[model samples]
Target chain A: MSAPAKLPRWAELGLLPAVNLVAALLLSGVIIRLIGESPWAALKLLADGAFGSQEAVGYTLYYATNFIFTGLAVAVAYHAGLFNIGAEGQAYIGGLGTGLVCLWLGAWPFWVVLPLAILAGAVGGAAWAFIPGWLQARRGSHIVITTIMFNFIASAVMTWLLVNILIKPGQQSPESREFAANAFMPGLHTLLGKVGLAFTATPLNLAFLLALAASFLVWLLVWRTRWGYALRVAGQNPAAAVYAGILPPRVTIAAMLLSGALAGSLGLNELMGAQHRILLDFPGGAGFVGIAVALMGRNHPVGIFLAAVLFGALMQGGSQLSFDMPRVNRDMVVVIQGLVILFCGALENVARVPLAALLARLRGEKEAE
Target chain B: METYTLIVLLLAATIRVATPLLLAALAGLFSERSGVIALGLEGMMLGAAFAAAAASAVTGSVWLGLGAGIATAVALALLLAFAGVTHRGNQVVAGMAVNIMVAGLGPALALAWFNLGGQTPQLEGAGQRFLALTWPWADAARAAPFPGLLYAELLSGHNLVVYFAAALVPFSAWVLYRTRFGLRLRAVGENPSAVDTAGISVTRLRYQAVMISGVLCGVAGTYLSTAASAGFVRDMTAGKGYLALAALIFGKWRPYPTLGACLLFAFTDALATRLQGVALPLVGVIPVQFILALPYVLTVLLLAGFVGTAVAPKAIGAPYAKEK
Candidate 1:
């Protein structure tokens, strides 16, 4: 019954997450083997596909941009001690907002539509999340269950709207018409070419930069502000927060609103930047991936940024691996994502005890010397 | 007479649909009643569905498939226990991990094994799938008309698993209320420290409860692929597991009330299917999506209204640790 020693900040933030990631990857490798494939060969191909070319890197960053938006969404809600699993629905609604604005104002210049689209996206997502947030805060409803229900509700609503109301006239598919060229989100390559820079064509766009900017803003809002402080206090200790005149209900709602708005930005990249049309499942499970990112990143902006890139690499590379290996598929990445969530989030303490004991022994040896 | 017959058919469908939900809700009843969050019910069912279907396809035996399903679900339940119970980690996060993992793992393995794009080969023939059991002398009874048709149509022709699910509810009530294990399980959920002090191991009781949950989910999932549908498809459970969770909550964690909720939800689901593209006199054609979304919307409303006052177990979601 030895008491575990406390970990230093650096080890706590960096080393522990790194060790957990390695463990997750090892389990993933075992899964790869179980599927009758060589994990090493698959890893090599995955690495090459993710980083071998400028095009691959761009794709990775493009996927990373979506993760960043969603990762921050989860991180913000986590900080407020709320598990806002409705990010998927929020992102879907947010995409709807972007699509509506683009369809209605396609005649306008890019500059005019972009800001309005962004605002609409955030508002749409926040509106979708508001119901669960209000229910949790004012009515004592469990956020997790309510949010899960809302995901199905959102899916049904989106399907109905797309199939019946929003489908392009005379088209057999359940998707809207493409946006005008003026309304298109300029890709990084196109924007770079205009400035006389030689860059390969890819889907990477200004939203990537927007995601980084959002990360910085999240850090500011979550750490540097009074409201942020109050939010943290409320999450950490509700009784103390009440004594300090911070209302838990208010914080809960506000945090959910912010989280939903951030999640809404996923559409800015997927719909506005890539698809340019309203389609089914545009969020593409990125909202769920964000939970993994947030957990791995320890709910910090910088960590989330790195974790999002790692997931983005997996997304980009897994597709590449699927092409090379007939037996392996992109779903393998999801298996790894689950492992990461399991090792890093659920079984986090499984590693902590051993690491602490090892560190204590090493420190003792150094002191004796 | 046509309307009456249609109503009877609808009732039959409701009973059929309610089978899986009832099984899963009872599964959840065990886990949550023991203070462990059973959010991974969806994953458990999916894993079992895939295992049952795949095993049946390979072995050509329905009983083997049943065994495989139960084994897979029990393994997943143990994993949840390792994470949520032994490690004292966040139960919700652990459940989500199981869900996400199974979602990917099922398809990945399916693609690798069968090369059929995440689907097992369809279960064919008598031994590979569960067939409906006609009650004894059902044809002779049908000749009597009226109540005979009702008995023949509604009660007589369900697969064995459906009957098992129906019977399991009373069995569950008996086990939950009358057994000493149930008393200890309930005591642990309500106050683990008290139970711990009473010379009982909280972890063991919780583990037993969770394993029982797994077994029930296994049966439910097998019933889905083998009895309800032909074989497992990707995400074939669709939202049934979640619907069961909602039913569990709606019932306030009781067996009989939970069965009522499942039947109610199933009835609505059947009505949605029947009402599709059918115009009504006053309401016109209600969107099928709206009807499909009703159960969820109702659950949310219930949670928000005064009815949401349903109290959870005292130690629910709290990781129990002895005083150091």
Candidate 2:
């Protein structure tokens, strides 16, 4: 076989994303038209509904907050070469932990209760992720299989707990009791009102800032730390990492655990800051949506944040778009998401091959020197 | 005295419950052994179930519906194979795309085509109903001197698909272990490079394996809608496809052992259904959801514990790129 060529410049990597986005939007428009909806009108409605008012912006940010956390969770694992599909399950279990803590022990001051709940959520999420990680690392079991199985197990466990153990009396819904007053995350409405910027009630809270902070932290952790270097090495070339005296299994496990903890905190944010209680479908498809976000972001923290915001806007706007266009389902957002992932995957592959060939050619030149 | 009869009833339920899983797991064995991970089984089953119901409703022929179901599944498998093998897309992502697309598109299409979002019109007439067997010994067992063939009821008296599923276990084992085609397919999965050197097209072999899996998944879907429930419902397969996948892993990706794993989970589901209200011993105290979760929990635990060093087919998820 012929030797591969040299790497493509960074400009090429930058151009590919723009091309993918355009392709995705065009495809989505065609689909909308095929469904007999006015594509332009729908787009207009989407924009108007998502950002027309301060309240809408706040809601979009609130939704973005959850997506940011989950997206970062997924991105972190992807960087480590682990497909952490159990984020949904981990988020649910974490919600349960946060909910229980808030309900029982939230009488403490707000600062104390909030951090404790977040910690509990992270720990719960990490533990949930550790199961599949352990299996993958130690037994060489596939993460995909274990994580998928764990999703069902987690759902069943939550359903059982909701019905029998944690059911709030007289509320027949599959939900836990509301968190105590002190446990609730202070919404933007409260803080903004003090500064006279409040216009309407919006659930966006301190958690959004925390999610942003977490994204920066993840960037640093994945790029700056010695552990991060080991993870990257292990992911890119496991055999090489082993040769370098790194325990790949431990790195894999730690990466997955960290990924899960981030996802778990998404649930905590929703429960304590937005919903103020754990509902059966609280995590919903947000965890899966995070996968799309991570993919679109190319597994970068900043990219994930932007992608999450875009998705969050779509979701928030899509719901309102239903009022203007009654025939279009909110699930059209899912179609858009699917299109994005498809395009992104195709783009990534197309870019990688040429880049790898280019890198190989450069290496050959260096060897000749 | 009646508890003995109840135990017998439970045994009967186990076989009944095991049928679909047996079929689906067998289908998974064919695909995974061929080096393609058939994550689209759930989608295939769902699509088949929809097609089967629609065909049976229109043509009023159970056989026609079953054939349509299988055809739909094959079509989907072909699409997946084309994308994963020919287009060189990531198999897992492509499989997942198929799954999400089918999950969404099936319901929408069902609504558009049949106006049935969840439930289809129930099957009617002799053509629609499954054919059962009646033997003289079986009759004698139920008669005065004895009961009907105790074993026949336990095993034989179901639809033809049940026997077909049970038989496929051994047949698949033979195919995987003894056949030349099976050897080539296994070689393609284990080492596509080696297979390519032998002048066999890895793409063609993997495609064939995936198509076979689709056909089986189609049959499984037919059984689910027509034979099992006599009607179609949205998301009727539920997570059974995933369960079969789990069983495939739990069985360490082998044929016969996978069948056994599927049966074990099916037995638990059947037992859960049977013991829902009856005042039994410790088992009865378990909630239905816990029992429902047992299979998944077992799969995780087994993966974490017993399945040390689970080795997938070497080229399982990699898209085969011929030398340029």
Candidate 3:
């Protein structure tokens, strides 16, 4: 096989990723067909469930909100040459922080609790990332392994907190009691209602707004700011960055803190907005999912946004598919997502050969003409 | 005293629990030494566990179950190796994606075939499970004194997998250090160009390394489902793959060190299991969470404080470029 030749702007920025995504979806379809379900029917259901109705759209967006935070978190770190796999643990700890703040200020108004809880969550998430970040910067320990270990550490800590220490008097399940109504953040339905548009009720809440704002800010920070330039430069070449007066340690620490904070806010959407209670496995697997999102998005803000939406659609739609189709279980949905992750992120190069050949041939023809 | 019995039980449990960790760490040793990190070790182990249990239950043959488990793990390894080593895509991402795929496929396939809540049917009867090996003097041990009892309790009764796990360390050490193939493998991990210049195929070496990783993981998984427990459950490996990776590091990636690290983790695990309720003098009553978290915390500490730029093979996680 020939080496991958560079593609034009559109293909590089768009066509290639789209092809990879389609390849992933097709493989997922084959997996479904192997299980005796019609892939077309599954796709139809997924599309309808994810986008057919207002409520469905709302749920999709709500899931997207968490993904956005996590995707952006992973992207931020990636741009700085760090793979922040600790986002799951960071989100868990961030939710812990959100839960603590909401509990402490249970009687407070929404306005008072919201900002404080967000801050607490950010701090909590950042704190969890700090040790690994510090080690990577100072001790030369690899961040990926340490961050993963931190996930287990966070899970054990969360389990300990939820079960033995905070098991809500006599509740069987290891979840805290619902937070006070005053601590509940406003949902998007209420916000939309205030704006005179009727919308379906959903877990989609002010957290979605926070996530959008974060996306915009990240785009600005990474592309439009001087600090971002330094971070990227450090990622590209640490020696050159140092020669140019950028400190690797400082850049690493800053990027990680920002990444951790964004990841942590993913929990706020669930705990403070939707569930209003902290529980076991609440982050679920969103942190890992963010890796796929960021990879598919190429670590860009707009790319991450679109990627998050697609994954969000898959999740919300997959849930409905499992409910409607007994043959296709939740594990099937996971398989699809896994396929997406594998093709789009891991085996992405599989498509580069033909694409590069085609692109190179077209370029040569144009030059000859 | 009661402490003596507790000590013996804890030691035995330590070996029992350490078996999976040892096998998995040895698996990690192969992959990492050949420069492809097996982050999907968790997924491979979990998938292998489910496959082994399900196959054993269906065929009523422990060997068939082991084969099935090995086949699944090697299949996953092939995917990872193709992506990471051949296509030269990112190794960490490829491994992670494979892990997610395995995590999904194991339960999904289990559900399709068994319909028992993503769990395989229990492995029953004599051939379906690995029976504990009995010593020749077991009858006399029951009738006789403390030494016999100690011998019976400590030396006898572990399943065949434990013995295999024990033997694998020296075997791996011999393969990795004493042979020409081992020399080439280590050379490929440290400097692929040097090996390639010597007319060795780096791709072949790495593929073999990763496949060896797959085989070790299969053994680890079979032990988990067939011997460690009666059947496969969802996420039965828990985080043992990562624990094994940590042990690989804690052992400093050497055969002996890896074994010692697994022992330490297993000992801590046994302590956590045993010391759940008992109060101690110096430390007071330690919480179980602390003990459970001990292995992870130690791994982090080792990475941060003690390792001090000492761990990991050079060129690890890097794709070897043939021309560049």
Off by over 4 Å in 3: A1-4, A367-369, B142-145, B307-309
Give lDDT tens digits, candidate 3, residues B192-213: 9999998999999999999999
Instruction: Write one digit per residue (lDDT tens) for candidate 2, span B121-224.
Output: 77886587455655446655654322443555765467787888888888988888899988887888888888889898888898999999899999889888
**Candidate 2 or 3, higher lDDT?**
3
| The candidate that achieves the highest DockQ relative to the unseen native structure | 1
For every model shown, what is its TM-score relative to the native structure? 0.98, 0.89, 0.97
- Model 3 compared with the native: what TM-score? 0.97
Give the per-residue Cα lDDT of candidate 3 at A281.
87
Instruction: Sort candidate 1 into its docking category.
Output: medium
Q: Which ten residues in a row are the worst by lDDT in model 3 chain A?
A: A1-10
Per-model DockQ: 0.69, 0.36, 0.60
Misplaced by over 4 Å in model 2 are: A1-14, A21-41, A322-327, A346-369, B58-61, B113-152, B155-157, B277-279, B282-284, B307-311
Over the stretch A1-369, how does candidate 3's per-residue lDDT look in tens digits?
A: 123466677886798889988998888888788777899999999999999999899999999988999999999998888989999999999889999888879898888888899999999999998888998999888999999999999998999899887678788999998899888878999998999999889988999889989999999999899999998998888899999999989999999999999999987798988998889989989999899989888888889889999888988998898877766777776777677778877787788778988888888999999
C-alpha lDDT of all candidate models, in order: 0.90, 0.79, 0.88
Lowest-scoring 10 consecutive residues by lDDT in candidate 2 chain B?
A: B142-151
lDDT of 2 at B34: 72
Runs in model 1 with CA error above 4 Å? A1-5, B143-145, B306-308
Q: Which prediction has more favorable DockQ, 1 or 2?
A: 1
